[model samples]
Target: MLGASRMGAAPSASEEGEGEPPLTPSTCTFTRLVAKMAADKIVPVALELGGKSPMVVMGDADLKRAVAGAIAGMRFTRQGQSCTAASRIIVHRSLIDEFLAEMKAAVNAMVMGDPLDEATDIGTIISKQQFEKVKAYIKRGEADGGVAHSLSQVPTDPKLGEGYYVQPVIFTDLPSDSPVITEEIFGPVTALIPFDDYEEAVEIANSSEYGLGATIWTKDLKTAMNAVHRLEAGFVQVNQNLVVLPGLSYGGFKKSGIGKEASLEAMLDHFTHKKTIIINMT
Candidate 1:
């Protein structure tokens, strides 16, 4: 039997006790049943977990609009804290100066402090470990000859420091294989890679190990549509910001992740089996 687990209230005994509550008999039985069924499966099971996502902005894009959208895509939802954030941004070489200038201005304007504060635009990292990991990436960026620009000075509050907090960081002129460019920082860190032309932009975007999602910004409808067809990512956004629509299937190609989620069609594919039925009553 396939059992779908739902999030419920915490066990009362665990809340009252000093030590954690032991797994209940029912939960233990369910775990064993799942293991046994998996062990006896006739076919191999495959799980496509997660990865680092990249966002590419072409030379033809409007610098102001693209930079603003890129900032939102990178920093939205507290850096997504997920596998799908726009971790790397590839812009055309000609637009690099304008793009970076606008991006830096936009990022510098973000308010970072108390999450509960209505004016706060940025929030803390998930944990101390995560904060350290992100900081290490910042160091790596500097060491790799990538310029580091912080959105704001690190907060001075001791209480805030106790929690995981990192200022948004942007690394510019990053080499293709640099850690800042190649690996998933998984924090509020982004790298700006410059390409020469449209062909080069598409090449750089597709060069990554993860092909989760991509955004194309172009005034020419033909070029935008061509990019939509050529990109390796599962989810492609043209002349718009990255967002989830109820009607669109969301997933990635290669190492980004597996299967699809969100859309009703994707959900149906995940939850239902298809069979071909034939009738010979003629």
Candidate 2:
């Protein structure tokens, strides 16, 4: 059976129902009996919700290095269909133009087509629904009066016609309140927000409702460390896209997501519970 809920509707009985078989005969009488199931028999569940992560470029950051890192952060792993994609870019006002130019060049060099094609740098999105969602955000960006810089025209291949594909799009001079800036587009769309100083940049980056992951690119150790302290994100990357080391914890704060995954720490947290042991040697 299929069940659907209207926007803002409260959870329904059907939605709350769990089909898992009861662990004991008496447990079946309870309204929600899944809690009584045996720990060893219970199936594990995981949720991978994406986020609107940002990249903050400090004033003293090397422009070449910042641009390279920013592009990699934004466009890495096929636009990071995963939850950790850096969709927003916050740069110092002085270097905004230079960074945008370099980013544009880098995106333009990407060859979008078949995922199996050795020459293809970017591939088609997962589904038509996702494609439409991404295209709607692109249209919203144009409607919100943000300048759209598309890197490549849509391909004419009939084989690719069966799937959804969109060119990489960048928006400049986006207002802080714009939907493109505020919402998670979950595609190859990036917005460049300019700030006059470090404090202002931190404010803009932390103002979002979602606080999953953030990136700070700078050559100065002090600036990177300071920004890391100020940013209110679960994962803070410094001058690189590989933020969480293997066997380290990975998760988000605020509305971006719940709980953690992707490391030994998360596995231990999920699998075990701590019990205080008290003993008195009198």
Candidate 3:
């Protein structure tokens, strides 16, 4: 029998954990370990797992501001290797062209170099295998009728040429239901699917199985408020995206995860237990 220590975390047995993922699985180890923890050990488990987050852009949204939010939300600096990356962009049909132009300029201006370098905007993919997987996804995105703007075009810098680095890519014109949009790529790739109205935008955003986070860009206060109520995600941002802090409980709805994280709720529920004591006054 694999002890809780072997799996590398025991919520009941351990001290307070800092805000970081306990495991970064290179294989099926995370899955196997989680199964053992929940099924066999029968202990408290709060899973903070995968996501395919969405960002919706209404026609009235400030393009420049929204584009900046999109870049920040994309996690391009981390090679888009984040669970909360809002990489699925559903833009207003009338604004797709303008959005694409701005996004291209934003991505082009980013500096991809050593992770430790202060000036570098982004770093390489985790490994050769992961790099190949991202490349394959880009190819599949094209096969699914999405037009790729930039396809893994590594920079000409001699220092960055030899490794698992890939440039950020944007795929436009794909259907809302395309696998590239539905699946979590976990790379610095985003898709642009156009919608005719706010209703369709919300519909498209809520269609994904994973609902970790979402962003809504609009100037209409009523529309933004409505979206805040309607969007099916644990974390919803209006007019901005991808802000994580200790005060906010981080987790996802549906298949994204099991419980809350990084807040008092998580600390009390998952990391601590409840006990009742009764005494008789004699």
Candidates arranged by lDDT, highest first: 3, 2, 1
Q: For residues 128-236, what per-residue lDDT tens digits would candidate 3 score against the true structure?
A: 6556656766777787788999833466778767767887999988876666787776788889889998899999999987778999999999999999889999999
Per-residue lDDT tens digits for candidate 1, residues 214-280, read 7888888888899898988888887656577678777677755446766776667766678999999
In candidate 1, position 266 carries an lDDT of 66
By summed lDDT, the worst window of 10 consecutive residues in model 1 runs over 1-10
Q: List the residue pairs that clash in candidate 3.
A: none
Per-residue alpha-carbon lDDT of candidate 2 for residues 1-282, written as tens digits (9 for 90 to 100): 000110112232224344221111111122122223433477443333346788998888888888787777776337545455677889888899988999899888878887888988788776554565566667767877899998865568987777667888889877788767876665788888888988898898989877778999888899888988888878888988655567666776665544567787677666666699999999
- State in Å the error of residue 280, model 3: 2.9
What TM-score, to 2 decimals, does candidate 3 have? 0.85
Candidates 1 and 3 compared: the better one by lDDT is 3
Off by over 4 Å in 2: 1-48, 279-282
- Model 1's alpha-carbon lDDT is 0.68
Per-candidate clashes come to 0, 0, 0
Error of 2 at 211 (Å): 1.0
Give the clashing residue pairs of candidate 2, or none.
Answer: none
**Cα-based RMSD of the predictions, in order?**
9.0, 9.4, 8.6
lDDT of 3 at 239: 89
Better structure of 2 and 3 per lDDT: 3
